[model samples]
Target: MDTIVYAIPVFMVMIVIEIVTTIIRKKDYYRLNDAINSLSAGMMSITSGIILKIVEVTIYTGIFSAVALMEFDSSELWVWLFAFVIYDFFYYWTHRMGHEVNILWAAHAVHHQSEEYNLTTALRQTSSRFILGWLFYIPMAIIGIPPLVFFTVGLINLLYQFWVHTRHIPKLGWYEHYFVTPSNHRVHHAKNRKYLDKNYGGVFIIWDRMFGTFQEEDEQYESIRYGTLKPLRSWNPVWANLHLYSDMWKDAKATKSWKEKLTLWFRKTGYRPADVAAPMKMPDIHGYQNYDPALSTSQQLYAGVQFFILLLGTTALMAVYHTTPTWFDALWIIVLGANLVMNGSILEKPEQAIKLECLRFSITASALAVTATLMPVASIFWLGLGSLAVLSLAYLRRYSSATEPTAAIES
Candidate 1:
């Protein structure tokens, strides 16, 4: 079983606690649209992982079988501890290179796109990181670490980092020296001049300290600005994953020399061929503003309800994905992805939100009806989906005229 699947409930509970804590303290840490968008990107990543993760594990197992130096005993506690520590060591380099390399950053940038540093920000992840991220773990396989051990430690490292993506946690004086605390991880997520590209450890900060990438969160600087240098101005999850890759492709095509075109992706982060590089102004961090678009109460409620349905669908898919037919998995992924895209559109485009919702409901209903005729789907499933569609359409239609014009905070 995937360890992350088991962590979902704990993640939800922590998010709820964080939300309540922020409310009690009167802190403006969470935004509805941004939080939902973060989760949408995360769900997209997990759903896509249903297939990609298999490829990753297969490749790792193949490499281990062919070239492992020696086999380690899986039952030994020492072996598990060693693998856990070594995983973090490689994670530091993998994460650092993710920022230093252009193509890698294209995928890694999704996690940093959110302006608010809350619990949901921790869930914000890239669907495409599997493209090259698995290469970093090849060392473990070569060292003869069992795949199960590697996978388990990798999950532990990942789960450890989640709690650090918050504002409520303060510096733990001595512990900060060794582990990746919220203070140091906060610097990792910040786009501020001094904090950019520092603290790349997954669970341990010693890697950053030893390698000279560590930057403490300074009180002298104004409140730390969170996000990438070029803000992801839209709420679209698919675009969030593709925008940087798209920019890189456009730059690759526009550059004059063939060599520059081919090498741009391998060059340092944010590199552009001089011939095609436009004169862009550096962002003023002092006046930084989040990318928040206005939504009416009805629209917000619609987005929330729709997102909850999508969340339940994603959870159900995750629980049974390994046992289900591949075709079913593929279709579920598609339906869930489309729903997420439409939900993002509803958040950003209020005038068209009702229309989009109606279209989605109609298409879904039609698809379910067609599937029911050809397959063994339960009548209860059809009944539930029909009820949801009717109630959702009626609710949206009732408040369709109240949605306001799209408004956003200017950067």
Candidate 2:
């Protein structure tokens, strides 16, 4: 939470800097605001995962603290430094596995969704890392690093990675061969087949070098195509996760055999469409691709204003709910993770998903209110907000899906 608090101000400064630089260069691209909004969806997904991890770890500690009893009672900086390195090692492997495994890719895919690369792209992180990421840190627990120290270092490592997302910074001199820099990270985000799974380092590129997964940003031979092999046409956060899943599901269902259906989920994306047709040609997707800035001034301005307001409101909401949970807080997390998915579901040409997500959000919000009242968090605050959530959801559901959308709502 402290890390989240600190990042708020940092995000503000970088956003401003990104804008001024873009405008000064007169480089045409989509509004930086749209890119930032996309970042929010990315962060929301990450936040939800964070809350879930807190809940799980609290449970893990509560249950295992006794069995895994420790003798140490206080501070030790050296131990923490050692722990940080160990944690990074764990992160390297987990990050690598995320790319290799299909299930893990679903969660990591959020970061790669942005068609453009910029400072905002750095903020585009996954919403589902907490689902399985904590398992990687169990070694720290086994080694007896206190939970407080573990959490602090994890936050520090995350904060460290955010700045490396920008293209504004060139290679970090000789340090380029040592730590993870913006140039190295650019390669990590690239989808060029050669750069696909390289540069899997957290703080130090040494790990990648030692592990043989390191790839330099080759200007001539190996270029970069940002974003995923598949594109997310809409802006809805909720749909981001489910869109691919839904596509896979539809294709799987259409398969002739049960075995084929079962394997489809594990196969590479776009697999089950099997004897896949010829590849459709696409644009460069990086260094001035996708939404052209020269052509989209109005949309960018609108999205920028909309996001500023939404984030302000969200920060206020977090403050209001500060007293709710001592164990785990999922309020903002849900908003960030599900917002896009819900928005996307609603926007599909068919309209069934939009209706379904509204219903789901309504049910979940109301149930949460009831659960809060019945549990330790029985504040009058949640009850009222939950009621508001229910009503707001109902009203949103009133929109007619029969008509073509005037604007894109889902990401």
Candidate 3:
């Protein structure tokens, strides 16, 4: 919990520094509103992730943490250095299998489905990673990497990954040959035909080179697409993670042959009926696209400024919450319920006027979370009603953009 408690303040400082640095460098490509919405989703998803971490860290790492029984500072400097590489080796296989197997990909695919890549994309991780994720860490226990060492090194490894998600950094040349620099990591995130399944290294590039999965960035294939060929195309992060599962389940049930059913489940991601293979013909994103998403100029400017202020407010809320107040509970109950409903809403109409609706959502959610900070809730149940109302409105308004179809890009 100290991690959560201190993290708010620390992440606040970091985000402020990042935002200000972006402005100073004239590199603010994020639409302000989308940034806030994505940040809110990321924070909530991180909260979800930590809940699962409690299971992995306490339950699974409990095995290694019990290594306190073995008398040694096995977590010492040289020991930890070795453990990091071993952990990376385990991670490499697990990550490789995730690309090959459909079930595993469903969980991992959530991270790559974002069309926009940046610091936020790094945060756009899978909530279900905890499911198969412990398998990768299990090797640490066998190797006698103590629970303390296992936990600490795990955090360090994960933190090292955060910097690797950026397009801001170019190739570190020879550094790419040793460690998993941003250049190598960018290739890992690519949806391009040739780049897929390459650069599977976590912290070290040697893992990929040794495994024969390494590929250098190609100047000829200058374009890189961030999202999967078929995007989730929804604002709801929860559904974003589950949509592939839902599609796969539907496909598995619909298929006539047992082989086809198995193929539907494990062959590849976004696999579906021949009639529903929209992803196979999806438009290719050519040229340099990063940080910037699909919003227009006016909406981009508006959303970006709103994101700046709301992020400040979110950080402040975290800083101030010494005691979980009635309104805080109320706000969460309402927002989380609405968030789930938003997930179902997207799967229902993957092509909808979400950009317009998101502006409204950010305004309302910010108002509620902010108001709750000041006013104690009369009833948490009432927040549930508010969530329901908002969800219903989302349903009614989803496809109201007839002037321009949601799928059509209007500049």
Candidate 4:
């Protein structure tokens, strides 16, 4: 049982509170497209984790079973505390290396892609981190830490990092020295020359302090631009995960030497072969603008409603993925992924989004209708999906004309 499942409601409540607080303070911290895109990325990560986590746990458990150093008593308080602290220590290196290494940065960059620093930015995660991230925690298994203990501590460490994504929280005097606070974490998310790759702790700031990676949020520097040096200018969730890898592949193919092509991903972050490396101008930190595609009121409402529907679908998929049949689980995952892609497309290209939405809704409804007759699915499920499809199609049809071409936005 993932503890994060239980914390979803709490995460939503806190996000709402943060939004309200920012509104009351007149601080422009959140943007609709950015938040929705962040959450879409998060949904992709969680849904993909339904399968990825099993592989992670299996590997971790197998390692622990094979090399038993000395098992600690799981019931002991000290064991939990020690595991929690040690987990952060390992997380520090994992995070630090994520900045230094190119391939690792490709996965980690998803979290920092959002130009706006807010609660949703915390939810923004990479689905592909499981590719290499699991290697970082192998020492825990070697130390005979129980899988349950390791998992719980990891979740706790993750939960602790969420609140620190907010900008509303100011610097805490002495507390900032010990824990990963919003002030220090802001420095971590910053793309500024002085703040890049600093403060890599998950929960404790001490690891960064010890490793000489800590940098305070400097007041003298112009406002910290929150994003990668190479901006991910689109809101497409699938593209968000694939864009960096795609760039690397293109770089590898264009490189003159085979060794440079093979070793490109392992090179330092932002490394490119000289032949393919084009001199690119970095965005002026003081004048950087976030990626915000304009959408009419109707289009915004359509995207918002469709997003909420997909959110419910994602939540349901997360809840029942283990107990469901493999094919059914795969089907839901594909549909949900398609939903995310369509939602992002809607945001990026509103002119043609309604047609895409209608096509998606029609296909989904028709599939559900066919599946219900062939399987023992509950009547309520059919009714709910059927109603959603019908209503969504109607809504799209009603607003199809409003989303007409004005200016084409790049995706």
Off by over 4 Å in 2: 28-30, 46-51, 59-74, 248-299, 325-411
| TM-score ranking, high to low | 1, 4, 2, 3
Query: TM-score of predicted model 4?
Result: 0.94
List the candidate 1 regions with Cα displacement exceeding 4 Å.
278-281, 370-384
Candidate lDDT values, in order: 0.86, 0.62, 0.62, 0.84
**lDDT tens digits, residues 1-411, model 2?**
334755776786986787688778785333453475466675575456544566657744654475454633338778788868887888898888777766567777887788767777767776666666666666667657777777777778877887887766777689999899989998998887778778988898889999999998876765466777666655667666566657666766776777867775665543554443443344444533442222133323333443454455345434444555533356544543444344333333223434554565565455456446534444433544455455544543543423232333222
- At residue 25, candidate 3 shows an lDDT of 76
User: Evaluated with lDDT, which candidate comes out highest?
Assistant: 1
| Candidate 3 residue runs with Cα over 4 Å from true position | 4-41, 62-75, 257-411
Better of 2 and 4 by TM-score: 4
Give model 2's TM-score versus the native structure: 0.73
Q: Model 2: how large is the Cα RMSD against the reference?
A: 6.6
Number of the candidate with higher TM-score, 1 or 2: 1
Q: Please report the candidate that would top TM-score against the real structure.
A: 1
Clash count (model 2, backbone only): 19
Q: How many angstroms is residue 388 displaced in model 2 relative to the true structure, after the best TM-score fit? A: 16
lDDT tens digits by residue: candidate 3, 1-411: 334455555655655666676778797434443344456456555545433567787755666656434533673688888877787888888888888778889888877776655666666677787777687667567546777777777777877787777666788877988899878888888888788888887788898899899998875776666677666656566676688788788877876777777776667554565643444554555642432234444333333443443344334434444446655644653454354444334332334436434744674557465655454432232354365345546544633443222233421
Q: How would the candidate models be sorted by lDDT, starting from the highest?
A: 1, 4, 2, 3
**Which has the better TM-score: candidate 3, or candidate 4?**
4
- For model 1, residues 1-411, the per-residue Cα lDDT tens digits are 455677888998999999999999999898889999999999999999998888889989999999999999999999999999999999999999999999999999999999899989999999998899999989999999999999989888988889999999999999999999999999999988889899999999999999999999997887888999988988899999999999989998998899988999988888888899754556897786678888767678878887877786677678777765777677767777888898899788877866787777766666566456534432433654665686677776676655566677653
